[model samples]
Target: MKLTLDFYTRPQCNLCDEAYHLLQLFQDDWGFELSVRDISTNDTWTEEYGLRIPVLKYKDLLIDEGQFDLDIIRKRLHDLSSEN
Candidate 1:
């Protein structure tokens, strides 16, 4: 089985950029599919996320928000993948 994640972000956000980079860095190791969405592109997303950019989601599960450690995300992804 393969794990997939939704990475919610917006333009000109440094944190979002960092999160994207971190995900890309671990893509091979974690072997997961990533779908990046810019909240600013949609009205619903803009209202829903607002200032809470860079939210990571695995299906209905919330993985993390705001600033997070790369290792922490990796561990969480590992755990989630293991359950599959």
Candidate 2:
């Protein structure tokens, strides 16, 4: 099955770039899809998630991911798959 992930990112953020890249790699290897949004352009989103770029959302709920990495991504995906 295909899972939907909302990726919040910015243009020049290295961290965001890395997170997006990792997301792409994981999406290719695993069975999922990504929807990226640039929160910097949206005022409300910028205010709420300015510092928290590269946020991932599922089921309209934001994941509390403090740091981004491969193991963390894998774990989150695994955990989410158990919900259904």
Candidate 3:
């Protein structure tokens, strides 16, 4: 089963841009489907993540937020892959 990575972000966010670039770089290596969600388009999403743009989630599990930590996400992905 391919994992779906949900990226919650909004426009004009520098951190989101950086996180997105990193996610793109990791996409091929991790083999996960990327789903970009513009929080501004959804009220619920905006409310939940208004202060937490650039959030990364694998299913319901949050991988990272804000500036994003590559090492933490990498470890989580490694662990998740091992479980499959």
* Each model's total of backbone clashes: 0, 0, 0
lDDT of 2 by residue, 1-84 (tens): 888888888788888888777778768576679888898789987887888777888866765443676676677777887874
Clashing pairs in 1: none
Best by lDDT: 3
Off by over 4 Å in 3: none
Sort every candidate by lDDT, greatest first: 3, 1, 2
Cα misplacement distance, residue 61 of candidate 1 (Å) = 0.6
lDDT of 1 by residue, 14-68 (tens): 9999889978888887888899988988999899876888899898887888996
Of candidate 1, the 10-residue stretch with the lowest lDDT total is 68-77
Better of 1 and 2 by lDDT: 1
Best-fitting candidate, scored by TM-score: 3
TM-score each candidate. 0.88, 0.82, 0.93
Q: Please list the Cα RMSD from the true structure of every candidate, rounded to 1 decimal place.
A: 1.3, 1.8, 1.0
